[model samples]
Target chain A: MQVLYFAWVRERIGVPREEVETSAATVADLVEELSAREERYAVAFADRAALRVAVDQTLTDFDASLDGAREVAFFPPMTGG
Target chain B: MRIVVQDAPFDLGEEAGRFAQADAGVGAVVTFTGIVRNTAAGDLKAMEIEHYPGMTEAALTEIAERAQTRWSLSDVLVIHRHGHLTPGEMIMMVATAAPHRADAFAAAEYLMDYLKSRAPFWKREITADGAAWVDAKDEDEAALDRW
Candidate 1:
């Protein structure tokens, strides 16, 4: 699976996207696994309320199931018009 | 329906004119263009728009399709620009053509409201001090409740 970040999350995480090998069944579990790896991931995922998630290019919740998902993106709320 | 995600600037007049001329049944065409605004301090150098490559087009198309389902639209056009944009430059535009003015106007507004919050694009305002990500406003989210 690939984990992606955007906006400030990408800045904080220091990378836009990366391939991750995980057995996590849910988005939250994936976050936990990544957060445990380094300080940057921990800092970026520190405030979940300020973040949004998308699974396989579709907007979803942090508790969304990642079964057969190929990509997961985390970013701030969109501000486009 | 047409959705264009690009780093280049788009001509509002040309796009609007072409859209209005597309369908002979189009009785009304409503176009809205969003511009990059300077910060309150009047020091904004540029506005950087970041968007997911694959999801941006999908999200815009979905928004346009939803508008079409709800309104009597003949055609819908959405063009959003990414990358560094200076102040006073056009950022994006939405044009909706319908059989009547009411439908055209309403559908355009609905598309704008949805694009503001639901799209995968994020904006960062660059100023002399620093660059800051624009926060999504509560009113933008609340605007959807009316529809």
Candidate 2:
């Protein structure tokens, strides 16, 4: 699966997207897996309230199951108008 | 419904002209455009908008569809831009046509409220001092509950 980041989350993680192999069952679990890889991921994942997630391009909750998600994105709350 | 996410500038007058003619049976057409504003410090340079390409279109489509279901709209159009933009530049526009003025006005406002919070686009204010991502306002999220 591919994991994507946008806005300051992308800046903090130092990349926009990455392909990773993981057995995480949910979005929170995936965050845990990614955070264990390095300090930057840990820092980016540190404040969950400041972040929002999408599974396969649809806004979803952290407890959302990632059973067949092709992509997951993390970013700050949208400010679009 | 037409949903556009583009980098190039859009002709608001031309778009509005076309939108008003979308349905001859419609009696009212409401259009709203958002412009970039200078920072309170009065040294703002430009605003950069970022969006998830695939998801941006989908989300706007969903919002427009919801508006269609909620109102007696004859047509709807939404255009939002990304990339670099400067103060006074047009950021986005929404138009709704309905048989009555009240429905058209209400639907347009509904679209604007949803677009502010539900859309995937993020904005960064670039000033002489530095660049910073604009935070989503609590009021924008709260506005959605009215619908």
Candidate 3:
């Protein structure tokens, strides 16, 4: 599956997108897995309350199922318009 | 409905002029334009907007569809720009046309409210000292409760 980060999350993660080989069933599980990989991921995922998630390009909660999903994105609350 | 997510700057007058005035039944046309502004310190140089390419369009379309379903709107137009934008430049605009003033006004406000928080766009301010991301406001999120 592919995971993406945006805004300051992208800055902190040091990459916008990456293809991850994981068997996580939910967004939270995926975050936990990623956070375990390195220090930057740990820091970026430290405060889950400050982040938003999207599963397959649709806005969703961290508990959302990643069943058959191709993409997941994490970012701060949008500040558009 | 016209939805435009572009990197090029748009002229409000030209876009407003091209809006659908052809339908005589459309009695009220309400428009709102968002402009970039310097910080209170007045040292900001530009606002860099970043957006999720595919998701931005999809999210905007969903918001527009919701507006149309909730109101008796004849037309809706949304235009947003991404990339480096200087202070005072227009960032985005929404125009709503309806048979009555009430629906037009309500739908326009709804669109603005949703676009501000729902769309997958982020804004960063570039100042003389440094650059920083603009934080989302609680009021912007609360505005959706009115609908």
* RMSD of candidates 1 onward, in order: 0.7, 0.7, 0.8
What DockQ results do all the predictions give, each relative to the true complex?
A: 0.92, 0.92, 0.95
Give the candidate number with the greatest DockQ: 3
Residue lDDT tens for model 2, A1-81: 999999999999999999989999999999998899899999999999999999999999999999988999999999997
Q: Which stretches of candidate 3 lie over 4 Å from their true place?
A: none
Q: What's model 3's TM-score?
A: 0.98
Q: What class would a CAPRI assessor give candidate 3's docking?
A: high
Error of 2 at B108 (Å): 0.8
The candidate with the higher DockQ, 1 or 3, is: 3
In model 1, where do residues sit more than 4 Å from their true spots? none
Q: What are the TM values for chain B, all candidates?
A: 0.98, 0.98, 0.97
- The stretch of ten residues in a row with the least summed lDDT in candidate 3 chain B is B15-24
lDDT of 3 by residue, A1-81 (tens): 989999999999999999999999999999999999999999999999899999989999999999999999999999999
Considering the true interface contacts (CA pairs under 8 Å between chains A and B), give the fraction that model 1 also has: 0.89
* TM-score of candidate 1 against the unseen true structure: 0.98
Q: What lDDT does each candidate get?
A: 0.95, 0.95, 0.95
Weakest 10 consecutive residues, lDDT, candidate 1 chain B?
A: B35-44
What interface RMSD does candidate 2 have?
0.5
Model 1, position A32: C-alpha lDDT score: 95
| Alpha-carbon RMSD, candidate 2 | 0.7
